[model samples]
Target: MIHITLPDGSRKPFEDQPTGLAVAKSISEGLARECVAMEVDGQLVDLNRTIENDAAVRLITTRDPEALEIMRHSAAHVMAQAVMHVYPDAKLTIGPVVEDGFYYDIDMQPLSEEAFPEIEAEMKRIVKAKIPVERHEVSKANALEFYKNEPYKTEMISELADGTISFYKQGDFTDLCRGPHVPHTGFVRAFKLMRVSGAYWRADQSKAQLQRIYGTAFFDKKQLKAHLEFIEEAKKRNHRKIGTAMDLFSFHDDAPGMAFFHPKGMAVWNALLDFWREAHREAGYVETKTPIILKRALWEKSGHWENYRENMYTTEVDDEAYAIKPMNCPGGMLLFGTRPHSYRELPLRVAEIGLVHRHEMSGVLNGLFRVRSFHQDDAHLYMMADQIQSEILDLLRLEEKMYSQFGLDFHLELSTRPEKSIGTDEQWEVATEGLRAALDAYGRDYLINEGDGAFYGPKIDLHIKDALGRTWQCGTIQLDMSLPERFDLTYVGKDNEKHRPIMLHRTVFGSIERFLGVLIEHFAGKFPLWLAPVQAVLLPINDDLIPFAEKVASTMIQAGLRVEVDDRTESLNRKVREAQLAKTPLILTCGGKEKEAGTVSVRTLDGSVHYGIPMQQFMQQVTAHVAERRLELDLFEK
Candidate 1:
């Protein structure tokens, strides 16, 4: 008999070699029906795989996060089969699931729109066939022979060590994979063929370009529909579109990956900088700035000249080589070395809103997220060993304050030292303990991710949750002993001897440009009063009321408020509509009645109209909204 431990901490003895499906059926029919895959003794396996020894079991279904991944993997296989049916000669490469969908790379030429219908039709046929996907284990030699004609697959097999490989088969189609896929091909109900493009086999420019078909899928029809609708909505809110609509920013071909912030965009930029400066000052952080170009020897000493030379842009000054700064740390290190310090002046926190540049692949160049030039909210702390815990605690506290203000909920993950780390065991022990105690002091829950740290140190990452429920890694705190040792950064101890200082590198908003894009998407282009480029717009009902509207705009602007005037010959309703479309928070209209009564008609983004409020009263309401950065600002001004 074999004892199987279930997820609920209960054990059941099976008299013979029973499959995971058999165990599930014994427990509950509902669970058995939903169960798609299982794990035995920490190894994920197919439900049909027989379990003969004592082990731990976990059944994964559509309800599990990992199940979505498995289902999408099977969906990719169905898509591959569909493609093969349409173009019998098309050679398959890789079809893997990502984020919310799957993409398949095939070695085909010049695929166009005319191909989608035939491929989709073939997909329907495969779905109707309800083909059972059988998984088989094959030796490495067998796999290479089976895919001898398929160069990509053959290359993959050649790279594999001497071991058994898993292959999935549906109908006459089979592909090499390691998977615990869904039950059958018929399970792909909600699927969509999004787009097609060309991609290099391994993203290497020298490699042959392959045809890539991108698609998305969901478990149910409604969810898929909603997903498509959500995508459409996101397109509407895309910064590329909204930036032009609001006259915020633009991108030029000459400076492909650089953004040109217009006047309105400058207002938003200043707003962020103002808030950042205020927070850093209150958090005991001293701000510093560094030059954009530095000597090549500096980068060489930082180890980036060797490892990151490909990404760093080089130039020459007076026949000597210099490199454009790709990072701010080396400059910060130079500053730390400029002055000798003592233990009494320890825990020195230096911050920089430094601009950096790098050569990113053209394929991966996104709006503001993956730009060639951007600013980092970077900080580096030089402290004694005893101050490590308190420094991390301070950084976390500041991170919480900044993120909460942006309506971002964050989770912490403590990444342990990697296999090839630079620190001694004693140093790692002290640093790890410091981080653990800091986490405990805040009473926050965090999971240990083994071997995910940087090459030089251990760290903690804060994943910020967006409105779409997606987590973006935006904050990090890394402890480094190697850099200090390399730079010979020292502080005098109480015994008058020099001791190496521990360096803690941290960033709250990892990239200012990316954070700005996130803010745009999170707020859905309807920025709060404080962050809005034009917080208020003054609208006059007619030509006669133009003077009063301008007066009100001027007054608001003088009071440190961002306000604009729309005194065009357009109708009152048209002006209001334009302001609403621009996503401005508040609009004050000056009609004859409002002008005569020393009042204004206030309107909001939500289309609420409030009539006859004194200008002072309306300003009070606006100030309150701006002060709180309210999610739902009151339209009423009385």
Candidate 2:
């Protein structure tokens, strides 16, 4: 008899080797009908797979998070099958599930978004057929022979180890995959073909370019519809659109990945920098400026020449090769080496808002988010080994405070050393442990991502979620031991001997440009009072009130507010609408009644208004709001 242990610690004894379906049926017919897949011994597998030995099993239903991944995987296969049905000449490469959807790269006739409707219809038909998905294990030789006609599949087979490979078949369509797919195509009840794009095979530019079809799936139609609505909302909050609408920033073809900040955009940028500087000062950090270009020898010593050369841009200066700085750490290293340090100066925090450039593929160039040139709010802390935990905790606290100021919610991820990292095993272990201890002390949950750290050290990454529920990686705290060794940085200890200092490389805002992009979407271009380019705009009802509007604007300007007066010939409604479109935090209207009463009517961005407010009272309330940096406008009484 084999004992199958369920997740709830219940066990069932089977007389013989039984499948997951049999076990489920023993529990209840309803459970058996609902289970899409099973986890046996913590490994996901088809329900038809027999469990011969005693093991733990968990049934995955539509409600389980993993179930969505399984269903989406099956949906991808169904999509491929439909594509093959419609275009028999199409050659499939690979289809894999991403964050919220799946994509299949194929070599076929040029496909466009216009073709999604027909492709989706075909997929729907296949789903209606409820084709059973069968899994088969075959020898590598047989797998090669089965896919001999498909070059991509054959290439994949040749690269695999000499062992058994898995393949899944659905009706007439079969593909090479190690899948724990849904039981049948019918399980993919709600799906949509999102769009078509171009992708190079294996993501190598020199390789064959293929058409990639992107699609999403859900367990039910309601979830699918909700996701579609979320996508539409995201489009409306897209930073590129909002930036153009607000006249914040723009990009040009001549300077591919650089942003040209307009006057209004600079106001927001300067405010953020001022806030950063004040916070850094309070946190015991001294700001520094470094050159934009440095000698190649510096990069080589820092390991960038060996590990990050592909992303770096180099220039020949006076016959010597110099690199346009892709990262600020190397420059920080050189700065530290410039002055001999003593242990008394331990935990020396040096900050730099330095510009950096990296070569990004043209196809991947996004607005400010994926720019080739950007500024990093970087800081390097040189501390004694014993001070590691405390320094890291301080950095974490600063990160939380900064994000909180922006009203952004963030999660932490601890990334360990990567395969290509430069450090002794013992050094990496100590560095990683220091970060882990700090996180534990903070009493917050964090995810561990193995083999995903910087080339020189382990790091804790902060991923912040915007209003629309999109996550962006912004802050990072990297603990490094290699840079000091590479640069021969040392401080005189109490023993009268020189000892290496441990370096903490960190950035609260990973890239200023990217953070701005995130902020644009997070606030939907409706900035808070303090951050708004124009805190308030005075709109006169007619030309008669223009002088009163100007007087109010001058008063506001004297009170250190960024205020503007709309004295143009436009009608009262037109000027008010324009101010709303501009997303000004406050709109104050002055007309005959308000002018005679020495009062102003306050209108907020959300269309709430308060009439006949005394000028001094209104100024006091707005000044207090801006001083407090309140994210929401609660100053006006409605």
Candidate 3:
């Protein structure tokens, strides 16, 4: 007999060679139908795999989280099979599951989006057939011989050290994979082909170019419908589209990925920076500026030349190599080393809004979200070991206060040490624990992301949610012990002996440009009065009332409101429509009646109109609203 321990710690004695499916069948027919895969001694495997020894097992049903990935993997195979059915000349390379979806790369003739319907129909036919997916192990030599016609598969097999390779087969289609897929093709209930793009074989530019098909899958038809709806909504909220419509920013072919902020865009940028400076001031931080270019020797000592050289741009100056700064930490380190410190000055906080450059691939260069040149709101803190936890708590509090100002909701994630990292194991443990302790003290639940930290230390990431329920990673706090050691930074201890101070690297806005992009989508270009590029616009009913409109605009501008005058020879309704399209918060109109009464008619973005408001009271109310930085407009409220 073989003993099997379940997830709930129940032991069941089974006869020799009992399979996971047999166990599920013994429990209940409904469970057996729902079970798509099983975990045998912590390793996910096919439900038909025989249990030969005593071990713990967990049956994965369709409702479990892991089941989705299993189903998606099966869906990828089904997609590949469907493509082969439609186009037998296509050669498969590889398929893998990505965040929220899956993709498969195949060498085939270039096709457009119009071909998606035919391929999808074939995929649905395969799923309805319910062909059983079987896994088998073959010798390496046999695998190479079996894939002799497939160059990509043969090349992959040549690199593997294992003597036996795994392959999954369904119906007349077979592929090379190490997978824990669903029991059959029918498990892929609902799936859609999202798009087709050009990709180089194995992601190498020199290799053969292939067509990559992207897709997503879900268990229920309703879930698939919801996902498609979200995608459509996101397309409508795209910052690039909204930014151009509002005339706030633009990108040029000459600059490639750099943004050109117009005068109106600069207004929004200045407001955000001003707010950041004020909050940092209250948090006891002193701001500083650093050089945009530094010597290559400095980066070598900081370890970036060895690990991050590919992403850096370099040039020769004065017979020496120099690099445009890709990060602000090394320069901040140099500044810290310029002066000696005492324990009394411990926990010293320094901030910088530095512009840096990175050579990002053209494929990933998004509008402002992923750019070549951007500003990072970086701050570094030097403190004693005992001050680590308390300082982290303070940083968390500051982050919360700043994000709340934007009306954004956020969650915490703790990322531990990465594989390609510096510092000793002990240092990494201490750094990770310090952040963990601070998060615990903050009284919020956080998720652990294994091996996703910075090169120097573990970190905490703040992912903020937008209005559409999508999360954006905007803030991070990393604890570093290696940089201090590398830079030989020191401070006098209480006993008058020198000691190395620990460093904490953090940023509330990971990139100001990216945060601005997030804000654009979060508010759908409808900014609050204070953050609006043009807070209010004045429209005269006719040419005769232009003087009164100009007078009112001057008064509002002097009162610190961003006011504009519509001096165009357009009708009042046309001017109002244009202003509304521009997302102006306040629309003020002056006519013969209002001009004679020393008043103006007020209109807001929400189509609310109030008549005959005195100019003086209007200016006062607008000024107060901006000064308070109110997220909502309560103007003309009784």
**lDDT scores for all predictions?**
0.85, 0.92, 0.92
TM-score of each: 0.94, 0.97, 0.97
RMSD of 3: 1.6
Q: Which residue pairs in candidate 2 collide?
A: none
Q: Which should have the higher lDDT, number 1 or number 3?
A: 3
All predictions: root-mean-square deviation over Cα? 2.3, 1.6, 1.6
Q: What does the lDDT read for residue 535 in candidate 3?
A: 92
Output the lDDT of residue 24, model 2.
Answer: 89
User: Looking at model 1, which ten-residue stretch has the lowest summed lDDT?
Assistant: 629-638
The residue-by-residue lDDT of candidate 2 on 233-349, one tens digit each, is 888888999999989999998999999999999999998898899899999999999999999998999999999999999999899999999999988988999988999999999
| Tens-digit lDDT string for candidate 1 (518-567) | 88888878887898999989888778778888888888887789998898
Summed backbone clashes in each candidate are 0, 0, 0
Off by over 4 Å in 3: none
Question: Which stretches of model 2 miss by more than 4 angstroms?
Answer: none
| lDDT for 91 (candidate 1) | 88
